[model samples]
Target: MSRIAELTSLLMPHLMLAPIGLPMLTAALLLTMKEEQQRLKLGLNILSTLLGLLVAVALLLWSHESGAPATMGVYLPGNWPAPFGIVLVLDRLSAMMLLLTGFVALCSIVFAGARWHRAGVHYHTLFQLQLMGLGGAFLTGDLFNLFVFFEILLAASYGLLLHGAGRTRVQAGLHYIAINLAASSLFLIGASMLYGITGTLNMADLAQAIPQVSAADRGLLHSAAAILATAFLIKAAVWPLNFWLVPAYSAATAPVGALFALMTKVGIYTLLRLWTLMFSSEAGPSSLFGSLWLIGGGMVTMAFGAIGMMASQRLTHLAGHAAVLSSGTLLAAAGFGQNALTAGLLYYLPSSTLAVSALFLLADLIDRWRNDGASLAPYELDDVAPFLTPELMPTTGLNLDEDEEVLVGRVIPAAAAFLGLAYMACTLVIAGLPPLSGFIGKFAMLTALVNPLGLGSSAGTQPGLPGWTLIALMIATGLLALLALTRSGIRHFWAAHDRPTPQLRVMEGLPIAILLGACVALTLQANGVMRFTEATANGLHAPGTYVRAVMTAAPIPGPTTTPTPERAESSATTKAAP
Candidate 1:
């Protein structure tokens, strides 16, 4: 046992880098193989993704077990000191994100193996590269490398978006590429400006420098931060800057869409990390910089997303809008800067992401099922049944048993039942209804917003106007989403009489089930998950701890030897003679 413990400790640092390196190496190896060997490639891709998931789980457990001020594992790739070397900081936040990325990637790759992998030339390679980029982005401790990983992921996403190569995909892919290219340029400019102002790109170093920045350059610093935030906001699909998200995400393949769900959260994660670190109460004049902008913009984004959802007719478009809604909620919660609210948002993030991804996958199956039958013509509002009157109802046939006794209920096909249940779960979760993880998360956030302090505290005060406004918006959006999803569900499952049951492959169905099953697990373990998120939030709010951990981390010592006695004596004698 002692030997195993020693071995594990020695190898843990290297394991910190495996999430990024393993996928990259796998992608490179995949390039050498022919496309004809797809089964081999598929197996390799799944194995790599599973390994990444395991590594992520291990890291999460390590971070959790290490306890607070939150143990941050800092790995210097070049064996150089902080602010000078490539550093990867694994904290609770980064570990959680890494785990989410691995799980989503694994599910997506498995789903793609059903057919989408064969849709393009280097699908598996690009998918692996996408995972590599996401892992790097989460683990990197510097702004420049964040940009590098951003480009890496976006470049890979360009190909994944156009996997099927249809006209719609080509159009959406072109727009996605153009917008991201522009955002990348902005990222570079903002990073360069910050580097010039602070003389360092490491996040910890930046945190240490933000408070000491000269008054003269403070405005420039704020400007640089805003410019950088604009880039992330665009990626996060926060309204106005998010015109392209619906079309782009709606057009991508199902598996690609599921993975793309995490891409938006990357931007959210960056904002959360930077805001809590650089603009905390300790940052003098820059304390909570841009809080109003985040709150106000997030509210507007939520409104836009709600309206978009209510108006959307296609399942894919509805799912895209739902993603936007989820992003908006997170952004607003982040703006509040309350520890409890932050914890709630952390819990909400994964629940909403999983629900949205499941919806995306389910949308493809439902659409295919619809396509398998006769197409229905569009109907006007008046044409939709205002209410099902007895006179208007059809009395065509009754489902009866062989004995002519009336059956209590109709027997639904297994595939159709699965689709309906999955869709229902997605709807309930996204709508933040009761008895699911989503409701628990939203309830926590609402409680925090209303109290802004712990319950039963004597000094508790009412939520201010902004808080009330956010609360109102959240409720309204939930109602709107419920209506929208219910309508879509009826059309897809209940109203359509001619559509055939979808032939769902195990590869396809299993991923959706796994994702939904995760939501169920979260619901069952809500208390434990909330505890973890609260600890993560507490660590994030205390920026000084993070700064100390990163800046004080020592590099691995290079090989060295003790001087021999004879050699030391001869050197001493020579020095004395001189």
Candidate 2:
């Protein structure tokens, strides 16, 4: 082979590992660095993120070109068979998630470089570890490994959430940690139950074994699945189970909050992956299991989110609830089980995630400006409204050399105008207003809900009351969001007392622009994106492809069975099956 061709061939098999491995290695190196080496840390962080983004993009493109779910890369570490060893599978869904994670992390890290990273020790290390955990979770091919990755990311997140120690953040972090620990325990119990029942921790093996589960044990399996789903739902910020999300997210510093926009989606992503693969139409009695629960829980979550959004006065709280809204919407759509609805949801997911992240960062900047002007003097009982003033400026200790610049005559208006316009763009995207990718996503969902068949096909059956309810909820949620954001925008930008325009650096502002720019690109390429998602949805409906790919690609011991001779023979036959 030619040298270039040989080199490509040599490295091609390991491409799937690059995204997960690079961040982990970077994080380990970062842990050894002194906190004072800001420049070195920042440079390494950016370089690592840039490389990860490139790898994720390459994986996405490769998966798109692969043309079949079975062809998507499945990397088994140590060259062991899939069910017997850890595997990293990269289908369109995983690849897309990887890309989104990389893109969002890149933007958040870059934005943080302007200030947030310096807020605490080992921020960059924790950030990279977070990426590693997310990537691993997305790519893993088994439930046991999923739990492992979840713990890794949650540990990193606990640190990141408390990065800048303060009363609010510390308190919120404690609650967040406590809740997730409980969830983790539930996760362990559920995984153990599943292993006890099916004798497999590999997701693909579980899919194969679940169908064969006896009627007598199906209820137990269902209970185990419920336990697992509950854990995921809590992480997804579903109603009642998600009380910790808003306070924790709102208390987090801006960049961490922005990166966290993807965390809830990770829960949604796991639900979609496991449910479709193991409990879809082909899973016999377990087919479409718990779907009603998904739909009902999702609707209630949306209702809660809408009410919260309307009531929220703070921007961070609004962003947190908006994320909840997105999660609820996706879960409901996933419950519908129609490929068309899922396709629309696939398009909607990334668009909404990007918008929420942008909103988090933007809200922080605006809040800084608004709160900076508050009175800093100690309260006196004799003074009226003694509790309403800020005891200290929001930027009390931060270096503000950039903000200290005095803009001459016309420059102030121009700067203010830029920030206002950016804020408006984010508002439009979040509220699903005209002409942006968010609108396209919601419009697609609505169209899919009305016509569970592909758009423009009259033969498609009309949806029932549930669909209509979802449609109404979607519309009402958007209206509520628009009103809430519009009111907040007016008060902050127009009615509030004029303060120094938030000092935004190029580094800080560029990340927002890039994210918004991605949204615009999604709008421009809506047709192509939708087409890809349609294919993805179809792949999701066909669980056999995923299972067969994992099982047949490498020989592994068959799922555990009874120790009787007949059962042993049966297991051998299954393991020997082509």
Candidate 3:
């Protein structure tokens, strides 16, 4: 075991590249295969996705190891020093996100294999490309690479959204493509402005430079940050900029929608990472920049999502709005900038994502059950009966012989039972009910808010009006979600009596089970998870650690060379003559 550990440590630097490299290689290999070779493609996709998940788990464990001198691992693809070559940093946050991406991708691909993968050409290839892009986005340590990966993912999503193309999907895909293109432009402009101001696009270098930037450039710097934030916020589905999210997400197929649950988090993750690194207390006169805006924007977004959830009639649309609500909560908590609150938000992130993803999958199954064989036959207008006619009046009671006994209850089918239980679990987590991870997470954040001083510290100042407002909003939104989901549940499960039972495949059902099971495990292990999150949050607030790790990471040394005797003699003669 010790020998294996030593070998792993030796290979750790190279292994950091696997998350991105493995998917790229797999996609390229998949592309070479013929369209009829779906079985092989499916097997390959599953194998690659599973391997990626294992790698992510290993990295996550490595990052969390207490004995390590530094938790962040820096890999230079080109063997050049920081700010000169491409770099990938594996830290707690990135590791967690990588694990999450892998888990969701595995589930999505498995679900897709049941049917959705065959919906169009290159589905597996596009899926792998999307994974590669997401992995790259999380691991990259610079702005240019971030933009590159963003485009990669966005391009892949365009094809995925339009897969099994229909009028609705085509329309939604066009809008999705157009909005993201604008966001990309904004992203490029913001990155360029920052590069012009700081003279480097490396995140750590930017952090170091921000403190020393000239006063004259400060305005420009903030403006660039704002523009960059606008792009991220749109991706995060913040209010007023989130008009594209529901239509796009709801229009997607089940597996794709489940995978897309992580898309918005990318935006939130970037905001959390950059805000702390570049605008923390160390940045004089720029400490906590845009904090108020985040708070205000987040509150408004929560309200909007709540209202949307209540208004939406479709289950898919309801899930989309729920995602928006989760984003709002995360954004607002980030704005608080408290270590405890940040820890709680980190804990909440995965819980909410898993629940929302499960809801998306579940929505599809429920819709099929409700609509299958339940469509009414069309009739001519002349055949319609008059409502006022007594003979055609609706009857309230069943007609039966007086001696017949009514059956008390009928046994529910296995499929219906599974759907009901899964739906109930999703509802509990999404609505932040007690005895689940979501509730625990919200409770932790609420505790942090009421205390206002650091967790376990002596009492100090209380949270301000913004904090109070966020608290109220959280409670209110959770209630609204509960109401909306309950209404949806009744309409789908109880209101209709003649709907046929859905015949669910193992691939379709197992993923939802696994996701909800994870939420259960999270609840059971909340203490350990919260501790990890607190450590991660602490590391995030300390910018110096990240900067030092990145800036001091040395490139791999070149091959050693031995000087020839002739060269040595020539050098000696030249030295003597001089």
- Using TM-score as the yardstick, the better of models 2 and 3 is 3
lDDT per residue for candidate 2 within 1-578, as digits (tens), equals 59976786557658888877999999999999897787699889999999999999888877787565335677777568868888888888998999999999999998887666766778999999999999999999998889989999999999999876766777889999999999999999999999999999999899999999999999999999999988999999999998999999998878999999999999999999999988888888898898878888998898888888889988889999999999999998888777788888999999999999998888777776676522111112233122212211234423434432331011233555666887888888878888999999999889988766545322212358888998999999889888888888898899977577665666667788889899999999999999888878877878788887787666335587459998888889999999
Q: Model 3 compared with the native: what TM-score? A: 0.91
Model 1 is weakest, by summed lDDT over 10 consecutive residues, at: 373-382
Give residue 482's error in model 2 in angstroms.
Answer: 0.8
The C-alpha stretches of model 3 lying farther than 4 A from their native spots are: 67-70, 373-413, 454-462, 565-578
Write one digit per residue (lDDT tens) for candidate 1, span 1-578: 99998998778878999988999999999999997787689999999999999999999998887566577788889888889999999899999999999998899888777556665678889999999999999999999899999989999999888876656777888999999989998898899999999999999999889999999999999999999999999998887999999999988888999999998999999999998888887787788899888888889999999999999999989999999999999998888778888889999999999999999999877876776621111112133224222222222211122331221223335988898999999998999999888999999989999887663211112358989999999999999999999999998899988555666667778899999999999999999998899889888888787888788888878787786999899889999994
Q: Give the whole-model CA lDDT for all candidates, comma-separated.
A: 0.85, 0.83, 0.85
* Structure candidate 1, residue pairs in collision: none
lDDT of 3 at 302: 94
Query: How many collisions per candidate?
Result: 0, 0, 0
TM-score of 2: 0.89
Q: List model 3 lDDT by residue over 143-183, tens digit each.
A: 99999999999999999988766667778889999999999
**Worst-scoring 10-residue span by lDDT in model 2:** 375-384
lDDT of 2 at 557: 50
